[model samples]
Target: MRLLVTGGCGFIGTNFIYLMQERHPDWKIVNLDKLTYAGNRKNLLAIENNADANYSFIHGDICDKTLVTNIIEEYQIEAVVNFAAESHVDRSINDPAPFLTTNIQGAQNLMECARQAGLEKFVHVSTDEVYGTLAKNEPAFTEDNPLIPNSPYSASKAGADLMARAYFETYNFPISITRCSNNYGPYQFPEKLIPLMYTKAVAGEQLPIYGDGSNIRDWIYVDDHCTGVELTLLKGQPGRAYNFGGAAEKTNLELVRELLSILGKDESSITFVKDRPGHDQRYAMDFTVAQNELGFSPSVTFAEGIRKTIQWYQDNELWLEEVKSGSYRDFMAEWYGER
Candidate 1:
């Protein structure tokens, strides 16, 4: 099978590519990434000289219809897994225009291009945040959860999810979507909560804790998310959306404590901060659909995943350093400027 993975150079996307390369030797993988601030080609260095005979990379944007269509035809891609988007909630609050452009517009562009290209399967990766925070004593988010996105980022993703389902129902496009929980693992940009707190705590600097740190989220390992996505793309029913969960729910304070402990830092390392506007109080996922339908279950528990992730940061210290130095930003500016 030949697959085109948008944002494949980014965190979870890169891990997905690596996982596929390891498990399926005969499949060809094409990584299409815009190389934005969060996207880094360095994340893919492990695949530079691999045993897999079919792997390639393309630097492009999902919004470019002609480019997307051309690549689909040239590569004879049988499947497309879209992971591209403006994902930061705070950043989306700062500037929602970009989120609208990428998350909603870009999704529409890709959907139309895939339709024109005769695509076989298209899996749209999404987040459970689209369901907003569960009310007090409410049930966890299920596949039938109504989208009540709280922030611009989640709203835009919800818009994209709607479009994905629309295309499938209206045009009979072979599309599936998986709304997953918070993912934490290596290659994640330091801006997110996990990497951000880990970096500051390790540097002996104050770790910023938003609000009282009582917000809850279902944290899933990035590798497990990749596997679940793969299963959904292969065995999932078309036009259906799956919920992928780690069954690991933790409050933000608990998460910070875990990070501090893993980094061998003291309690003094933490600093409480102002709350985010429109912050969701909690998020949980009921992943029964994915488990029963795709046989997808997380292999790594939350505690185990955290240990592995912390070790990765320790071993890849130089990577963390370079990322902090801002060359990645410069590279994105330079590369995207020419395009």
Candidate 2:
């Protein structure tokens, strides 16, 4: 397969590219990334350095319709896997303009280009947060759940998802959406929970927890999410949406405490802070449809996934340091300073 994977320098996209290369050696992949604060080119250094590798990287934004269309034409791209978006909930709260531009408009551009090109498949990677919060005793969110996105980030994603459905309905576009739960693994930007807490715990800095840390999220290893995406790309029906999850639900407090324990640090490092506005109380995914149709199931348990994640950060201290650029530090300080 010849694939154009947008946002390929970011967390999940990087992992997905590596997984595809390893599994499908003959496949050619073109990575289009904007290299935002969270998108780190260092994540794919190995792939970029290999002269014989069938991989290519284009530093660009998905909102650029001309660029997207040209890349599709130039590469003779057969399919597209869009991971591009403003994904962080806090960042989206801070500024929603980027999320709107990238998540909604950018996705529409890709779908339009793919439709015009007569592409075989397109997979838009989304998050479980679009289903909104669940009560403590409520069941997990299935694909049929209405999109009740609360955060600007999730709303933008939902907008893009609806657009995808529209294209399939109106233009007969071959687009499929996959919504996954929280992902933790290597190459993840440090702004996320696991990496943020891991970095702070290792440095002996205060680990900040939002609003008593009772909010819950389902956790999935990056590889498992990547596999689910690949399956959707290969087999999913048009206009259909699929959900994938790790089946591991942990509260914010429980996750932090577990991380501290893994690092041999004490709970004294944890500091409760004011929670962000419109904070969803819980998010869990019911991926039964994906399991039954795509033969998808999470392979990594949270225990094993967390340990592996921390080990990767430990081994790649240089990467951790390099990715913590000036902008990242400023954002972290400013965002947490108010909390």
Local distance difference test, each candidate: 0.88, 0.93
TM-scores for all candidates: the values are 0.95, 0.99
Model 2: per-residue Cα lDDT over 196-257, one tens digit each: 99999989899999898999999999999999999999899888999999999999999999
| Local distance difference test, candidate 1 | 0.88
- Once model 1 is optimally superposed onto the true structure by TM-score, how far is the C-alpha of residue 200 displaced, in angstroms? 0.2
Residue 5's lDDT within candidate 1 is: 89
- After TM-score superposition, the amount by which residue 242's alpha carbon in candidate 2 deviates from its true location, in angstroms, is 0.4
State the RMSD for candidate 1. 4.2
- What is candidate 1's lDDT per residue for 66-178, written digit by digit as tens? 99999999999989999998888877886799899989999899889999888889999999999999865788999997999999999999999999999998999989999
lDDT (C-alpha) at residue 250 in model 1: 92
Q: How many residue pairs clash in each candidate?
A: 0, 0
